[model samples]
Target: MAEETADDYLKVIVFQLKEEEYAMEVDYIQSIERMQPITRIPGVESFIVGVMNLRGVITPVIDLRKRFNIESMEYNEATRILVLNKDNSEIGFIVDGANDVMDIPASKIEPTPEVVGGVAEEYLRGVVKLEDRLFTLLHIDKVLNKNNEEKRTVV
Candidate 1:
């Protein structure tokens, strides 16, 4: 039998955005929540939808659609907020939906192609294939750092 290192497989949380599926490693995720009321903030990037209280901790939320330059869609029952811890604070990303947690063998992960629709290349960590479905693995740091926007003061 072969040895299994921590890098042998990637455990990820799969989510949907538009018609494509995306994945983010579970290690970075804090929680996944159903759609909730968001209090809009003034003078922030258009992609930064607003902020919402997550169990009494005010967390800033950003619409991944807008962040990826994809057209906006109305929030429905399927929408979700993926909360993550960043710099001792919490931030959330609004996604179309999050529906899977799976382990994709590292062998199945490929370097991102030159052109993948919906999200920009910099935001992608790689492409993963599990059976017949493909998942775009997102580089969460790059996704949130694109604009180098100042971190908002969480109340």
Candidate 2:
């Protein structure tokens, strides 16, 4: 086997939530789109706003702020839907906006620090130290995992 380079491990798509910048792996991102009409589901969790018809397929819409326990903000022109695929399930995350795609070398990435609060530590894949700032890379699997577990326990 050959040694892995910094390019071999990390891939990211940056976006905004509550005006703060964040990113997740490009592999987990299915699509991004403008906000659309969503059908609210009664009795669902607060984070789960509702579902949307995406070219005839229904996809659940989640308020990323609520999911991460961040303060909610009103949607603006920059608002977008980040569709994520996890464990064969599709979930659409509503974010403040979408930013550019960044390829951070694995060497530049560090384990998520314990200082970041509200956003669960398990939800973070790592932190990428850029030229002047740090970008938190979210672990979609762990974030979605918690939601799936909640659903199972409720049933």
Candidate 3:
């Protein structure tokens, strides 16, 4: 008979970038979409891949590869856009591919070490180990705030 803490479990959306696995809490993810045409907007950081029109809304897309300084790869059939909601704004994160949603128990989650997957320490919420796999839980807010250049009027 063990007490259940609020941190006992977390549902995460796992994705791959530069061959490394990463996770973001499912609560923040609005939706997952296939690769879409992106309209490039200049004067922004390289990580900012520009924006795309989703239905009638304009959403900004970010390349996690570029954001984490990881090696870039061509977008193909496996590419995916993870729509995330922060506050009242919605943004898209372009990942190499999204695997699946997983429930990670708190016991398996550990605070981030020195570095995980070359991504900035500040951008990592923590790390977890499950089934011989190391999953880096990302802090999407910090990732998106890295440049904050994407915060603009979307029409």
Which pairs clash inside model 1?
none
- Best TM-score among the predictions, by candidate number: 1
TM-score of every candidate: 0.90, 0.86, 0.89
Question: Per-residue error at 47 for model 2, in Å?
Answer: 0.5
* Model 2 lDDT per residue over 23-89, tens place: 8888888899899999999998888999999878799999989888899988888899999877777
TM-score preference between candidates 1 and 3, better one:
1
Model 1's C-alpha root-mean-square deviation from the true structure amounts to: 5.5
Off by over 4 Å in 1: 1-6, 148-155
Candidate order (TM-score)? 1, 3, 2
Expressed as tens digits, the lDDT of each residue in 1-155 for candidate 3 is 79767779899999998768999999999999999999999998788899999888899998988988888888999999999888988899999899989988888889999845478788888899999899899987788786533456879
Q: Output the number of the lDDT-best candidate.
A: 1
- Residue 46, candidate 2: alpha-carbon lDDT: 86
Residue pair clashes in candidate 2: none
Assess candidate 2 and give its TM-score to the true structure. Answer: 0.86
Candidate 3 local lDDT, residue 136: 93
